[model samples]
Target: MKRRIQINIAGRVQGVGFRPTVYRHATAAGLAGFVTNTPAGVLVEAEGEDAALAAFSALLKAQPPVQARVETFAVSDVPLRGDTAFVIAPSQGSGDLLIGIPPDLAMCSDCARDIRDTANRRHGYAFTNCTCCGPRYTIVRALPYDRAQTSMAAFTLCPACQQEYTSPADRRFDAQPNACAACGPALRLLDKQNMPVPDVADPLAAAVDLLRQGRVLALKSLGGYHLCCDATDAAAIRRLRERKHRPTKPFAVMFPSLEQIRAHCEVSPEEEAALADPSAPIVILRRRADSALPAEISPDTHDLGAFLPYTPLHLLLLDRTGPLIMTSGNQSEEPLAVDESELTQLLGTFADFALVHNRPIVRRCDDSVLKLSGGRRILIRRARGFVPGAIPLPMRGPPVLALGGDLKNVFALTRQQQAILSPHIGNLAEFASYSFLKTAVADLARLLQIKPEIVAHDLHPDYASTQFAKEFPAHTHIAVQHHHAHIVAGMVEHNLRGPVLGIALDGMGYGTDGTLWGGEVLLADLCTFHRVAHFKAARLPGGDEATRHPVRTAWSQLVAEFGDEAEAVAAEFLPALTEIERGTLRTMIQQGVRSPWTTSAGRLFDAVAALLGFQGEVTFEGEAAIHLQMLAATAPLPPYPFELVRQRDPWVISFGPTLRAIVQDLRAGTPPAAIAGRFHRTVAAALVETCAALRMRYARHEVVLTGGVMQNDFLLDLLHTGLQARGFKVHSHALVPPNDGGIALGQAAVALAKFFT
Candidate 1:
């Protein structure tokens, strides 16, 4: 056995106090070594017996930073180069390879208790951080995490603080965000007119008073500024809605704790973990049987999105009672406030009371959304406390950046085999969202320090991001078809670098052929994609008017597929629509009056929900799809009535079989629950068969499912389990949402492929 051992620890080692912890552990074990921060990670050149080295290695990994993730360690035999003492060296760059950056974490329980304790020296400290926990991604600047390269640089260490920072045995050792009342970012409460409030002894008390009085307050947070109010009070929620000009979109809630959440809504073990994660993202939970939250929260739904505290400030704010309505601090459709000028310009009149802070937000990151399904935490929106760090693409490619689609926009930068997706901005149509996107794109590019050879964007000419991509005159701008990007993303995630069939389904995307496309099967390659099959063209009778009001889709489906008699017979589908709307829809379908053609699965979901008398008005995007998936959870195993037929030499799935089944169910007056469940199961079964047939010819080729439709658990589980059982490898998203939320990853991936091509 080797007498001496050496090891290189990598992944998220910098910006986190990795080396100090290493020294503490090594010295405690009585081993002579030196730990130095490398560009890649930390290198511990230790002189010890093999047995002792083995034990030290275990101890190193077992007690890593709660915020920092240790991806790997390379341990090997070393010649005796015995050092007198274990020490932490200064920071070093990790060559060309991108370094891992840890996400911001919630304040540790110890630090939290100290902050709440009035007698403690660090009482009410907002930036109280130890090596084990507190701001990582949020406060960091450059990596190889040192005091000088973070926001904490402004605060010189007091003598006591210096001692604690130097002592490895102490928790604050090398904690970059470490500070006390003597030194740190200060807070100032402001009135609506941009003037600081005069000597308010208790800002929290004032904030609570505003909340209780049904007044809106804009509070700056770890991620960004948020507009908060009492969610339980109807009048307050109504006032917030009017002030923000967001009539119906559901707002996220922050409760005191898990027990408080359980009191309001029913949460599964999976959902509880997601809510309690360091990210503290908005998690969708089922409403309890005795649900009584304000209707304004989930105006047209049965579930509520909830989150726990992720910051010391959040904990202090939640110390009192009522559920707080914490929504992004921006006007309707705009990105959350990040910049000082923007905050003053947009929110000056929107909030009655404004809680401001001096710390600058280098970049804006929205709170990530998550759902726990099948006992695994699935990221729906990879933002806020979880972004910018590169995730290795399963396949290798060159560096490039892709500006994502128009809605729920996120951008991505790819280098080597890793793709770093930028945080969620917002809908790009709004000027604030567009500006945030612009800043974030530049930020990631600067952070990675990569000059891109190519820029990728959606095929749509109207998307603001696409327009921005064209402005890069020197860079090669590749306009990828919207659906093709979706296809390539799925394939790239699975490392399926070769040509394969792709099924891209969603609400709408600009097709390569210049018509709206959604439900499509395409023959896709890295260079190009061909439309091989698609859902039968259906008339969107009211054009864009049909989206917010889905009953039009239901009416059109009836008239186009089952004739006028079916339209008259289907009263349940027409509930949301008035008599005039019903008459107008009938006329539009019969005459093909101003109808836009679409094959969107999202629209189909809306139609299905309308037919079953589920949700009438959609407060948010995918509202219908989300509720439909919930209904589908009650569905059982049954054969779907769908036929794979060759239409004009291309294989297409005929919804005719499924539509007929639904019509028959309507005639028999089948319960909406049974009908909705059967529809979900049927679609899943059809997809499995489609992939299975294709795989038979290719002899073991895999299937990768993507798009917003794949966000449906009922459909996803069906395809995953059913396809796997039939001996085919199935790939779906866990890190990113399958929806347009992850469009940037696909865009970046495709852009990288073009560089190699």
Candidate 2:
């Protein structure tokens, strides 16, 4: 019997050679079919013998293109049209936009081979790419992702390249960015003043030479520009850091191969997998003690952020230069430079020369970052290879746009049950970052063709995202509490219908009571939450200034614990402060002037780090805490004492006893490493105790751990282990970051849940 069937597939189906894959499969099965890209997804109509059609359908479901992720597939029987040949049809953009745009993929093995083969047409080509791998999200400008809707539209394909793109059997079939050296984006070398460098025949070679000569080169990459220099040269690294004004923060290193990465860092199976994954993120790996890399690459930490080349340009450069320090091409907290004008305008002072290209970047994306904990990769920064793809929501709702928090800003747009999060937009405290946020929102919304009915934002009124949400055209607006969003984001990732015991720990968020909260325990579901327990608050003597200087927070903590004796203790342990400065801080704490109380886990870590002799202001957001986590050595130290006070409805977990014990240890000459280890254990134990009690009272066993503080692998590992041992089902972030980068997803989820209710 002859039968026909039509199949509709969604999720990462566009711009990933899905139509070609379908054509090949249909032809191989001796079935007549036509495949085309639609706004909703890939649509295939096949007609043949029933057995052949069944086998073809099975193959399509079982095997998709390596870069394709099939989230939903539907097949239905259709009347036979007597089609006798398989054909790839042109894309139609009429239906609903339900398909996910493929993220930027790393260079595939075949493309790598092509670039390395001297006889290949693409040999030594910096922009060599096929359907398997190349720029996707960054170059894409509109839906029904054809070449005309992309940045590649400006570049005309040469005759030979056009043949490969038109051939259904070729690997480059329908590859939008497919090009050869004959007609493709070419690289150019420019001086610091944005003038073309004379007599540079090979820009890649010139860029490599400049890097080898200890000069900083701002090289345009797949998503944006990166400041590059030799990683092994301490002086060069120092010079680059000085020019960029990034003194102590770590710089990611790009190596040529996995073998070289293994030489400098301990690559576990999981870390190795992440480095080689298609996303090609910078994976945080443990540094080998005997390795000889320059200390300036990563100062004050035992971990190194490393990644392999994801683009042919990067591969060629790394092959010639070995390892280069690859950092974002922008001043400290500004937006990434995407085009030549922006690059020269922002990074002109830092780069000695610029390696640019003619190809435009439709959207700017930074490299994603990941760290391994409990043998799983946790996202530190989600961008590039992992974005523009939708995260499936547990329930469907009206369209919503979520503007995330100010720090580590990322926004989300929800269509039906899929939430599309924007790539990392950096700190909104900077005007440039805020502008980038707005631009990103507009671009992503247009690309997805969604005008949100509801707008969601953080409760913090002063956040740029919140302010934007206020002005955005939407039918409804909802303000989600920060900690509640953190916990709910984890819940959404795990698809949990919560009312779970939620542990939200981070730097600080505007609390419901008009205070700042971080160390909080809440019983939360998607729409609502109840704050059940929290860490006792401590005064931040100078408000925002106290966040920059850990010593101020430490002194305030001491005053809260030791009273009048706090000044003597400060004089002994905190010699970094002068007597006059100490008295002024004391008066601020006593008189309740500009001081605001916070129960932040990050502030707690900062205070302990300061007490352990880390003086002065932090160079980065979590510098002191990261250093403190690194200082903690493995030991079975007992936890410090803490008191759980049930003096009110919402109980307080007081660390006053723990502070006194830490002081006593400091007085007893205990090693800072041991104290740090003990402090971590104490925090883990207290949280476990709180959750255990809450589970008994509320009858909820599912516990979620989230927030910026959860980025600390040491603390996360302890909490994961302890909670599981106590018979609680624990969940944490893996796909999206635990930091504020994932806040938009939670905000979207909460808004949708509330609207549906």
Candidate 3:
């Protein structure tokens, strides 16, 4: 009797060697089956003895490609016509299998073996790849993940590759990225204007040599561009800094391997595991004092963000005996260059040469960010290795699009509780950024087959992303408050339904009551959040200007404390406002030209940084705050002081005492380093006291500390230690950044909580 079974399998079935693996198993079991890709998933009709059929099915469920994920399976009887031998057929391209585009994978064992093997056809091949590993989402243009639908379409498979691709028994039987030296994407070394450098056999080696000799090379990478230079060369690094106009904010480093990175930084077991994961994201680990990288690479920073190679090209480039400063190749505050036109224009002055490639990157995703928390390593920005992929939501519901915040902006599209946040798209202000966001979102929607009915965005109207969301006329627009989104984001990442005390601090956000809020203590659930506590609101002379210029913020604080009529104001302000033109400072605060009130911890850190004279002028966002914490280098933390004042019968953290003590220390000529240490310690202590007091009232020790300000290592370390000593379980971002960039996930989570449970 001829027997047949129809099997439907779903989940990361595309671009991950799935069909080939299954075909190989079925054919070896002597089952006659035809496999085809449908929009919903893979569909197969197999006819064989019950025993062989069962065995093939078992192997499929138990062992498939390592990178592939199987979410569900359905099996049913189907009438069989006498069919001989299993055969993998062409994709049927039916059904909307919306869920399973594979995330870009790191180099697999097979590819790694080939890289290290001198006799292998792909020996030392920079673009070597297999079905199980290599760029998937980054290289993909359209769906079905066929070679014709990818950036690799330009390179036709050679005779050997074609044979292997056509044979079910071959490892690359269904590999879409299958290519050899004779046929595949090849690397090209380009001169200053992106002209191909003629006659170079090992361009990677030559590029490394140029870098070792102190020349900057702008290398096109798996995602976008990277500004590469020897990490150990300070002069070379400084030259990069001058060229890129980036004076701090700690650049990311790319180590050759996990072992080398571990030797440079103290990697926890979890961090090591994440580093070795296929994604190979940039994981922030505590820096070892003896690390070989120059101090300027991460000046005044305690932890160094590092990663191993995700691409074979990176592996080939890093085969040398050292790490490279793999910083983003762009001028400050611009999106990374992906197109050749932009490369020549944006990175023109920065790099002397451009490593070019013919492959087209339809979308650009930066390498993901990561951190270790509570003995676990988790993703911060889920990109490169983890985009176009969906996070499981708590409940199933209608589709929604969440346009996240302005800084580090990433958006999400949701179907049910599952939200697929696009990989870090960028600031959302630049024209290129807006276009990237629009195109990537549309691609994700097309792949997932989702049509959003509700659109979520931050409350600020000026946000470029928010404005973009309004263009979606069909969706019901919903504006999520900045801190509310922050709190809900913490709740979503922690998988909590009950209310939790969330401390959402950042540079600035519009409060519901029409004032600026940064330092906020909120008792929040996914549904709503109550403003429970906050930092004292101080005057700012021109709101945005005050943030960029911290001296004005510090001076405004003094004016708030002593009023404009008070005497000795100059002497008191002079200690913190060193080098600020005194006449102009007093006039701005008194006349209130740009003076508005703000209660932002991020701004407070800026003011403290300015007061310590670490930085009076900020060229970029977060510069002042970054330098302020760096001043804590070796300063012994002094006694931190703060008072809980009743503002309209609600508790508020008063910076008056904090400011007074800082002034007293400055008048006495205390070391700026000590002042920085004291201020950080003081703020951390205040947070502990405030949150603990709230904890006593609410009976919840689980406090979530989020927002961009928490990225400050000094503040994070102090707050984590202070709160732990005081007996509170603290939760910070691990799965997502604690910054505005991660706001979309929270918005989706919050919206789902309302729409679902």
Candidate 4:
């Protein structure tokens, strides 16, 4: 008997060769059907033998394209029509935009083969791609993800390329970026002054030669420009660092192959998988003790950020040169350079020459960074191949947009039951980053055709993201507490309904009591949070300057612990401070002027780092903490003592005793590594004790660990074990970062729950 059915499928369906897959499946099954793209999803109608039709339906679900992720599929029976042949019909652009477009994928293996195959027409082509892989999110400017709606529209397909694109059976069918070297975006070699290198014959080869000669080259990449230099050359690395004003923060490296990277760093199977994945993020891998890479690549860190070449241009360049320092093409804390003219102007001082391409980048995205935690990839910076993808919400609500915290800024826009997070927009402290945030958010909203009804932002009024949220006239404007957002983001990532005991630990967040909070234990759900217990507050003298100089934080902590006697301790322990600076800080701490108290886990780490003589001043945001974690002893140590002062309902875990013990250890000639390890253990113990007590009182066994402090692998691993052993189902971030970079997800989730409930 003949049978007919209509199917509507959604989620990561468009631009992923779904219709072509369906067409081939139906034809193979001997079913007459038509498949077309609708705004909601892919729509298919089939009429054939009932057995064949059932098989076709199963194939649609089971044999989807590798890149496609089917979220929702619906099927309904219909009266059979007298259709005799299978056909891929024209798309119907009638319904409102509903489905998510897929992020850009790294170049596929087939394309790589073609690029390397001498007999292939696209031999040595830098932009060779098929339907399987190529630029998607970066080049896309509008919806329906067709070639006409992308940056590739400017470059009309050549005759031969057009034939492959039009052929339904070809791999390049409907491949928006399909192009041969003869009629594709062209590459050029330009000097720092933006003039073409007159003597250069082959631009890529010249760029490679320049890199080998220790000259920095700013190469235009898939999403933005990357300032490249020979990673093995210490002089070149030092020069690049000086030019960019980046002193000690680790720079990411791009090796040609997995074997090459494995030679320098220890790559576990999980880390190797992430490095080779299509998203192609910079995976943080532990360095081999006997490795020979230049120390300047990753100073004061045990791990090296490494990734394989994702683009053909990168592969071509790597084929010519060894590992290159593939850092973002921008000054420290600035937005990454995207436009050719703007990049040339900004990177003039940083690079000797520019290896640029003519293809326009519709949206600027930095490469994502990942680290393995408990054998799972944890996103440190979610960008590039991961951006603009929808994260399913726990519940549906009115459209809401969340402007994340100022640091590690990322925003989210919710539609239906999914929240689409924008790529990592770095610290909003810089005007350029703030501007990029605005433009990127606006572009995403426009491209996705969404106008949010509710706007969510941090409670901190001083945050640039909060100020941006104030400008949204159409939104309801809800202020979510910073640490609450951190905890909730973890819950949202795990898809857990909370009322969980959330341990929010980070550098700084605006507390509900008009103070800064980073070490917080909260009874939290999606809609609200209650501060149950917290670390003892310490003064932050000189405001933001305290973060740069850990010595100031140490003095403040000492003063809070030992009164006037702190002046002597400061003089003896903190030799990095000038006598006058010490005197001024003591007076500030005593007078409590321009000194805000913070119960920050980050500040405690900073104080311990300073007292142990690790680093008094840091070049990056979490340098001291990172170095402290790096210097810990391999074996476990007995934790330092901490006082749980329950003088009030919301108790305080006083680190005064711990600080004093650390000072005693410093004087008693204890090894820095031992002290560091003990300090870490002490912190983990305090948090575990707090959560165990909370579970006993509240009877909630679900414990969520989140915030920037959770980025420390030692602390996270310890906490994970301790909580689970105590019969608690511990949840921490896996998909997104535990840092402020992922707070936007929590903000969006909270806003949705608040508005709808």
What TM-score fits each model? 0.92, 0.95, 0.86, 0.94
Q: Please list the residue runs of candidate 4 whose C-alpha ends up more than 4 Å from where it truly belongs after superposition.
A: 1-13, 21-66, 69-84, 91-100, 564-568
Which 10 successive residues of model 3 have the least lDDT summed?
A: 565-574
Instruction: Give the per-residue lDDT digits (tens) of candidate 3, residues 1-757.
Output: 4579999988777667777888888888888878877767778889998888888888888997877778888889988878887777876745444343577888887898898899998898778787788887877777766788888888988999999888777778767788877887777888886777888987777787788898888888877888888888999989998888777767788988788897899987888878887777898888998877789888767779899888888888788737888887766656777888878874479887776666777668788887876554445567887776766665676788998987777899987657788888776666667777888778878767788888888888778878888887644777888988887777777777758888888878888887788999988888777888899987788777777788777767766775652236445544544444555766776786666778899888877776677434677677788787667753556655788875553479987888778778877988887888888888888888888888777887878888888777567777777888988887777667787877898887776666544
Better of 2 and 3 by TM-score: 2
Clashes of 3: 11
Please give me the total number of clashing residue pairs in predicted model 1: 3
Candidate 4: tens digits of C-alpha lDDT, residues 1-757: 9889999998777777788889889999998979998877889999999899899999889978766768899999988888999998988865555353578888777778888889999988898888878898999888877898888998989999999999886778999999888788988998878889997878988888899999999889988889999999999999998998888899999999899999999988888878877789999999998989999999888899999899999988897797999999887778889996677665568888899988898888999998997865568899987876778889888888899999989999998888889888888999989999999888999999889999999999899999999998765999999999999898988888879999988999999899999999999999998899999998899988999999899888987897777778777888888789888987897798899989999988999888888545778888889888998885878999998877787889998899889888887999999999999999988888888887778999999889898889888998988888888898888767888989999999998888876
Tens digit of lDDT per residue, candidate 2, span 8-94?
998777767788888889999999979998878889999999999999999999988777778899999989899889999877756
**Model 3, TM vs. native:** 0.86
- Specify the poorest-scoring 10-residue window by lDDT in model 1: 91-100
> Residue 281 of candidate 2: its Cα lDDT?
96
Worst 10 residues of 2 by lDDT: 92-101
